[model samples]
Target: MVTVSLPTPVQPEFDTTIHRRKTRPVPVGTVTIGGGHPVVVQSMINEDTLDVDGSVAGIRRLHEIGCEIVRVTVPSMAHAKALADIKQKLESTYQRVPLVADVHHNGMKIALEVAKHVDKVRINPGLYVFEKPDAQREGYSDQEFADIGDKIRETLEPLVVSLRDQGKSMRIGVNHGSLSERMLFTYGDTPEGMVQSALEFIKICESLDFRNLVVSMKASRVPVMLAAYRLMVKRMDELGMDYPLHLGVTEAGDGEYGRIKSTAGIATLLADGIGDTIRVSLTEAPEKEIPVCYSILQALGLRKTMVEYVACPSCGRTLFNLEDVLHEVREATKHLTGLDIAVMGCIVNGPGEMADADYGYVGKQAGYIALYRGREEIKRVPEADGVQELINLIKADGRWVDP
Candidate 1:
C-alpha cells in the first residue's frame, strides 16, 4: 500500500500596513469607481452646449486621449436634447467611455430628462438656491433662512429618488464660489464651512438611500482645497459612510503653474490612499488633462506597468549633449507602455542608478553609448542609434511599442 501524506495549509506571506479605505462601489457604465478599483481619471469637454456636432467632436477627441469619463454641461432644454443625441452616438462609437451630465439647477426637470441618457449626473448643490444678499440684508429672519434650506432639500429629494429608482449614479459637486449664503454664515467662510456643506448634501443623499454617490469639495485656493478634503475625510469616517471621494483643485490655472498646483494637491491625497478618482482641471484643452493625470498617477505608483523614463540633468562633467539626447528619447517613446528606460549623462553613476530598469543607455566617449539591462552590459550603440537600439530591445521582449 502507498503511504498517504496530508497537505500543509498555506500561510500568509507578509504583513502590509497599506490598507485602502473600504468604499461602496459605484458603476458608471463598465468603469467601476471606488470599492478598491483603480482610481479613475476624468475630464470635461469645453464645447458650446448648442453646438451638438462640435460637442460630439470634442467627445471623440477626449476619448482618443484616454478620458474614461466625460462631462458636458446641459444648461437648457435644448442642451438636454442635444445631450440625448450625443449620448446615442457616443454609446454606439465609444461604448466603454461613460458620459456624465452636469446640471446646475432645475434638478427635478433636468434630472428626469437627462437621467434617460447619461450614465451619471454631477449636481452643484450650491446652485439650487438663488441668493440675494440685498434681500437678506433687509432683516431676514432665522425662520426664513431655515425655510430656504428646507425648500432646497425638498427640491432635491424627489429628483434624487427618481434617479435612484432609475438606477443612475450622482455626484454632489460642491464649489466654493457657489456655497449657500446661510451655510457660509453659519460655519463661517472657511474650510470647515466647505466640509459642512458637503456633509449636509451627503447626508441628504444617504437619507434617500442613494448610496451610489461620489462627492467632491473643490476650492480654487490650494490651502482651502487641501484643508477641506482632509476635514471631509474625517467627517466621512465619523459618519461611517464610505462614499468614494473625487479629488481635484478646481480652476487650477493654465500652464505649468496649474499642473504643479494640481499635482501637489492630488499627490498628497493619493499618497495617503484617500482619493478614488482624480481630475486635473486645467485652463488648456481638455485633451491635455489626460496625460497630466496619468503622469501624476504613474509617479505615485498607483498605476503599474508603464514606460518610465529617467534622464539625468547635465552637469559640467557631462561628455555629450545630454539634454538633446534625453529629449529625443522621451519624445520618441512617449506612448510605449510597460517598460522602464533611463538616459544618463555618465556611465559611472548612470548604469548603477538605473540598475533595476528593463533597459538603459549611458553616455560614454564622444558619439558612443553603453547599453545595459539590470547592471549587465548588453551592447554598444552609436549615439544616434542609442534610442532606437533600446526600442528594438524592448520590442524583442514582446512589449507593445507605440507606432
Candidate 2:
C-alpha cells in the first residue's frame, strides 16, 4: 500500500483544528506539507527562468519574504535546460528553497529534464501535451475517447516513473480555464470537469504505485474554485487518497481586488480543513504574493507570522479617536508576533469581543481607556497614556520580547 512519511511530531502551540485538514504528507526537498505540518506558503517567479541571473535574484527576494516553495515557469525546452543553472546558483549562494518547475503543453519532455534539477514539478494535466481531439469538433466515437485515455497513460507514465525514482514530488494542477476538449465536451467546463481532468492523471500515477503527489484545482471564479476543491477532497476520500492539496484562484488580478478575491477562496476551504499549502495568484510581483499567502494563513489561525489586531468601527458610542488609536497601537506593537491585540472604540462590546485577547485597549470614558488581559480589566488609564500602558502591560506579563 502507498502511504505517507509524516514529519516529526511537534506540540500544538495553538488550536489549529480551525483550518487543519488531515492528509498524508508529501516531502518537497526539506519541507514536509500536509499530515499535520504547518500550512506551507508558496509563490512563483515572474521572470524568465532561462535568464539565470534575473531568476536567481527574483528567487532570492522571494526567499527573503518567507516563500517556502518557489516555482519557475518552464514553458519550453530551453527553460527546462536552464533549471540546472538555476538550481546550482540557488544551492551554492542562496538558501535551498524548494524549486518547483511549472510546465504546460510540452510538459512531458520539459518535466523530465526539469525534474532532474528541481525538488518538485507541477503540470496542468488538463493540457499537458494534450491536443484538441477530433471529437471536440466531429463528436467522439467511444473508441476515440479511449484513444485519448491511452495517449495520457503513454505520455505521463514515463514522467511519473522519473519522479518516483528521484523521490521528487509532483502536483497535478488543474485550472478551470484550461480544461481539455475531451473534458469540456463531456462535463462542460464545470467543477466536475476540472476534477475529472485531474483524476485522469491521478489514477495513472496510482496505477504505477506513484504516491508522492499533491493535487490542485484552481479557477478565477471563487464559486468554481471553492466547489472544485470541496468536490476534489470528497473524491480523494472515496479513493482513499490523502494527498495534500495546493490551493489558489488563478488570474486573480492585481491590487486590493486580487488580495480580497484570493483570500476569500483560499480561506473558505481552509476554514473547512481542506487545503495544505497555498499560493496567492496575484498579478503583482512574486515577492508581494508571499506576504499575502502568509496573511491568509495567519488570519485563518493555520499559521501565525505577526501580531494580530482586532478593532471596531467607530460610532457615537466611541469616546476616543478610534481609528487613530488603533493605528498608533499597531505601529507600536506590530513587531510582537503571535500576540492578539484588540483596540476597540468603547466598552459596550469591547470586552466581550476581545474575550480571548492577550491585551486590549478599549474606550472607557470620554478621554480614558480600559485595558484588559483576557476578560479581566487591568486598569483604567488616561487616553494620552493608553498606548504606553498597553506596551507596559505586555512587558509586565512577560509576553514582550525586544524587537
Highest lDDT: give the candidate number.
2
Residue 166 miss distance in model 1 (angstroms): 2.1
Those runs of model 2 whose alpha carbons end farther than 4 Å from true positions after fitting are 1-19, 133-136
Candidate 1 lDDT tens digits, 2-43: 998888989988743335567889988778889999889899
> RMSD per prediction, one decimal?
7.1, 8.7
Over 1-403, each residue of candidate 2 has an lDDT whose tens digit, in order, gives 9999999999869765584668988999999889899999999998998899999999989988799989999989899999899889888997688989888885788888988999899989777867755643955668877898999899999999999999999999999998888888888989999999999899999999999999999999999999999999899899888989999999999999999999999999999988999999988788789889888888878889999988988899999888888889988988888899999998889998998888889998888899999889989999999999998999998989887
* TM-score result, candidate 2: 0.91
10 residues in a row with least lDDT, candidate 1: 131-140
Q: Where does the lowest 10-residue lDDT sum fall in candidate 2?
A: 132-141
Model 1: which residue pairs collide?
none
Highest TM-score model number: 2
- Candidate lDDT values, in order: 0.81, 0.89
Error of 2 at 99 (Å): 1.1
